[model samples]
Target: MPFLGLQRQLGIDLDSWLLRQSAAQPHGKAGACHAFEREWVECGHGLGQTRARRECQPEYEDFMECMHRTKLAARLKKILDQRDKMIKEGKYTPPDYQKSQEEPRP
Candidate 1:
């Protein structure tokens, strides 16, 4: 093969191999090196434990908040459904429609 042609083929193959490796990224690998390092650190020393605890507390709080919000929303939805049922049974009356005499100026 011509020298330039061989070099071009080798360069193209190397680029393709690198692109494949980058794209495949082998399964179950942590996405970021810094984050993985921090996780590993958190598993080890007293300082790491303190730092991890501080970092993780917010995540725990956020998770709890999400659960609380979801529960609240579900409860609200159930109450609304009960209200609708009561209205259908003539046990509840919604407020009378009040037609505004004029649209409020924005």
Candidate 2:
């Protein structure tokens, strides 16, 4: 409530303010991709709109990959496959889960 009043007094839109704040902090929901995001921002910071797109291509691609989680998904899939293999070989024992009677069926 107080923040809303302050924003009104400062003539700042809440949505744009939140966007600026998120842009300032790279290590947000993007997690390990912060480095890529930071690099892309830095690369494109002062360049003109046209030049930035041309010069920051690599950084942009890296940032996009980080944002899209392509690498993370592959790594997770590999780890999951390894775990499955171990489980099948009886090298890893998974914890047992008991289904509750009160639980609704899907």
User: Which is the leading candidate under lDDT?
Assistant: 2
TM per prediction: 0.32, 0.44
Tens digit of lDDT per residue, candidate 1, span 1-106? 1245775866644422432222324575633333433433334335456675676665544444443567678899999899889988999887756433576798
Residue 43 in model 2: shift from native, Å?
0.7
Q: Per-residue CA lDDT of candidate 2, range 19-73, in tens? A: 3223434444534666776677678777878999999999889888767878889
| Candidate 2 TM-score, C-alpha based | 0.44
RMSD of each: 15.7, 9.6
Residue pairs in collision within model 1? none
Predicted structure 1: clash tally: 0
lDDT of each: 0.53, 0.70
Worst 10 residues of 2 by lDDT: 15-24
Q: For model 1, what is the alpha-carbon lDDT of residue 35?
A: 42
